[model samples]
Target: MPEPTYRQILYASRSEAGIDVDHILQQSRHNNAVDGITGLLWHDGDHFVQVIEGPESSIAATYARIAIDPRHHDVTILSDRPVGAREFGYWSMERAGKSMQDGAVMLARLERRLTNAPETVRQAFTAATKR
Candidate 1:
């Protein structure tokens, strides 16, 4: 098969009313993924990790929409890795909502990352709504 062109877009949004994050991430019926596109979305209660790959135009357009999408909170492009392979092939969009803790089980990874993140990121995180 030919190599794939990957462009990642990460965004955050509060969990919709009556909708579980896992359900939104695991289902392949989403209009975006249903088309000839492949990607994954992950939510850690505060932010998200999104990986989308396809033709450049579609990805760009989609990214624009995602930025303004009301369903999502803080929509930002984490990385637009070109020609990168999909990491979550099993899921058109995999949503992992569990707050993970290290083996010590002392601190939440999300909180740790947020605290450690640069001042700019921390500010953005604070402004963004959590899922």
Candidate 2:
């Protein structure tokens, strides 16, 4: 069978007070697997930068749920478009965060993963890392 038409979204948001990143990751991994979605979610204690890709309908439904999630505030869409293939296909929901021992290592890995991503998406991740 031919490859499914994939849609990807890059978005950023501020975490609400006392938000649990681990809980979000657990839920995302489970839901994304069932929905055939794959992507990364990065957090820096206060903010989030994520890239989710999958079938158009799944992406739409997932994002619709994200947009209204009370755990997030100031949600912003950095990029939204159809893609030829998954840019973050290796993980159902990989995560990077300040919780890591070496942020530089995480940033380097994120940069490499985004090597095939759109320029706008790349820029958004770069900016998110700096924050």
Candidate 3:
């Protein structure tokens, strides 16, 4: 059989005030599962940094929707590339909380699992938290 192909897209955005993270997670988890996508999302009150992985077509469609969502602005694509494997294979759309402990754990896990992640992704995480 041919090797499996996966695409990873990392993006950052500014979320509107009063946005509900739980609601977003619930909707995303359902939609992503149906679309065969997996990824992680981190929100720090004002900003969001997400990493999505899946088939090329699915990733493209999902990101296009996100880019136009009225809930966020200043959407920026940090990285988009083909990958040999899924870094976040288990979760459909997990959310990393805004606590220091949560941030540390998420960063460590990403470094360990996706050692080849681009510097832009790391920088996005930092920028999200600092905002």
- Choose the strongest candidate by TM-score: 3
Candidate 1 residue pairs in clash (backbone atoms < 3 Å): 6-83, 12-73, 13-73
| By lDDT: ranked, best first | 2, 3, 1
Say which prediction, candidate 2 or candidate 3, comes out ahead on TM-score: 3
- Candidate no. 2 TM-score: 0.79
Q: Which lDDT tens digits does candidate 3 get at residues 1-131?
A: 87799998877799999988898899899999999999988888899888899999999999998899888998987667788889888899988855855676775654443356578766665676573
How well is each residue in 75-110 modelled by candidate 2, as lDDT tens digits? 877777788888789899988876666656656755
Off by over 4 Å in 3: 100-102, 109-124
TM-score of each candidate structure, all chains considered together: 0.53, 0.79, 0.84
Alpha carbon lDDT at 112, candidate 3: 49
* Predicted structure with the largest lDDT when compared to the true one: 2
C-alpha local distance difference test of each model: 0.49, 0.82, 0.81
Cα deviation of 3, candidate 1, in Å: 2.9
TM-score of 3: 0.84
Give candidate 1 regions above 4 Å deviation. Answer: 1-4, 11-28, 99-131
Q: What's the count of clashing pairs in each model shown?
A: 3, 0, 0
Candidates 2 and 3, the one with greater lDDT? 2
Residue-level error in angstroms, candidate 3, position 106 = 1.0
